[model samples]
Target: MGNRGGILPAVGALALLAACSAPAPAPVAQTTTPASASAKPPTTGPSSDAPALGPGPGSQPPTTPQPPPPNSPAEVTSACPFLGVTESSATMGVVLDAYAVEEAKTTQQDATTYHCTYASRTGGRQLLDLFVTVVPGTGQIPSLVTAWTKDCKGPAKPIGGVAGTTRTCSLDGADSGDVMVLVVKKSHGQTRLAELYVRPFTDEVYAKLAQLLTDRL
Candidate 1:
């Protein structure tokens, strides 16, 4: 009986020790996020589809566009400034009471021509006809002079004191007694061709008129 009592006490002590040495529960981990770290970085540049910025302060505004000048000459109603009814009458030695001016455009040659006619008032007989053609550039002046005087059968006669080419040809067959004079002048980047047909021709009259026309070109 005494040994049994000792064994019970030893068993009770071992149970108490085991209960005291048992491990406690493990601690739970906590995670914390910072407020600044979660937010996106501030935008530093414009977006791809953003509206374009206009001129800044003190910048000049847009200027108004200007229109271009006319390419063709204006309509001419009166006689040419250089040659008029009085001049025509003196050159033809006839009383030219009728006068008419016509403007024509030649598309093939890109030229504008003014035709001036002077005739007798009584019978309406045409006395003189003058044609003044204005081309755009001086490059065609030489070629035009060559083409105009091709059939004249002589070298080009340079008019005195005038920068141009002139040629005179007498009309044969039924148009005999009539003479034609062709004069080409270039000025201000333009080529001007002046052709005059006069009946009962005189060299002095033609030369004088050609000088006046080319000088004013």
Candidate 2:
């Protein structure tokens, strides 16, 4: 009976040891509530468990820039004043059809006539050299010619009558045979061909200019 009693206790000890040695079941995940369980869905970007941020002052949308329009005449005019035609009205007794860019003073040593000219709109040709000066003390036309001739060569042959109590002479060695210098005293002002030189020289152009000075100036 003693042996049997000992065997029974040993069996009980083995079963307890087996129960302790068995692999522990995986621990179940707890169903407890997390601190962020009742939190709202993110309205902005994701972040750590920080508090929801309120909108800051004046968070308006960004503005987009617009491009300027092409083919604006006002912009072009503002940029290039010379690109447009500059015309003289018929009222300015002495009028030019084109813009007259002021030239540097001629190299002539003794010059009294204040000279300016408008280039032709037609062919980029020089239309006329407009001269203005005080009426001479002497009634001599040659003196005025002498004053005009200081810059230019002396003169060709003196030609009589094309217009207005005036005598003309071609500047000697002038490249253009169409070149001539006339001296005239008109009603409004003294309109003279101080020097009229044209390319592809011809006497016809010269004659035409002489007549124009007569009819117009």
Candidate 3:
């Protein structure tokens, strides 16, 4: 009985030692969850590359203005002042595109004047002045011619036109008839006096305009 009891204790001790000597199971690995695919991102401000909303507040509209129809009579008359005297009554050859017209009162007789400022498409600009005044007959003409002739280098001579006969005096330093001081008198069948002055560099147009004034007196 003692030997058996000793054997039993030895077996129990061996079992306890075996259980302690066994390796501990690895610690359970922790599982991690990834982010969701459908999640929304936070908003900051407007993007740098966003398209513009619309035109600026002070911008002009993007449209072109339509011009008047061709062969308008009013256009001919509008260009008549700067036109040569011969061309004053001309219907054709009037280039409305070359000019812009403005009207105002002149210093002489509160007269109505047409200032035709021409800007050439080819390149330069020139100003032509046409002044209109009234009188009882041709009596106001002699003094007018005298006034224009004072500064003229050329003799004042008869300038006949559709209106009537007057005179022109060349300015003291003018070149080959390019510019002259010209005057004319005429009644378009009435007693109103139409007198005009030419400064310099426009004689052909002046004579043309003068000759077309009246059919009668």
Best by lDDT: 1
Q: Write the residue-wise lDDT of candidate 3 on 1-217 in tens digits.
A: 0000110011111000000111112222222322111211111111113232222353333222222232222211122333342233242234322332222222122111222222222322222223232222334444444543343466765654423555555433444322332333434421222233333334455555444332211
* Pairs that collide, model 3: 84-205, 85-205, 85-208, 85-209, 86-208, 86-209, 162-211, 179-201
Residue-level lDDT of model 1, residues 96-158, one tens digit each, is 654433322221223444444343333344555555655556765555655544333345455
Q: lDDT of candidate 3 vs native? A: 0.28
Model 2 / residue 103 / CA error / Å: 8.1
**Runs in model 2 lying further than 4 Å from the true structure:** 1-98, 101-114, 119-128, 134-138, 151-154, 164-178, 186-197
- Pairs clashing in candidate 2? 156-170
Question: Candidate 1 — what's its lDDT?
Answer: 0.41
Q: Which pairs clash inside model 1?
A: none
Q: What shift in Å separates residue 91 of candidate 3 from its native position after superposition?
A: 11
Measured against the true structure, the TM-scores of the candidates, in listed sequence, are 0.54, 0.36, 0.40
The alpha-carbon RMSD values of the candidates against the true structure, listed in the order shown, are: 49.3, 49.2, 47.8
Question: Which window of 10 residues has the lowest lDDT sum in candidate 3?
Answer: 12-21
- Residue 59's lDDT within candidate 2 is 28
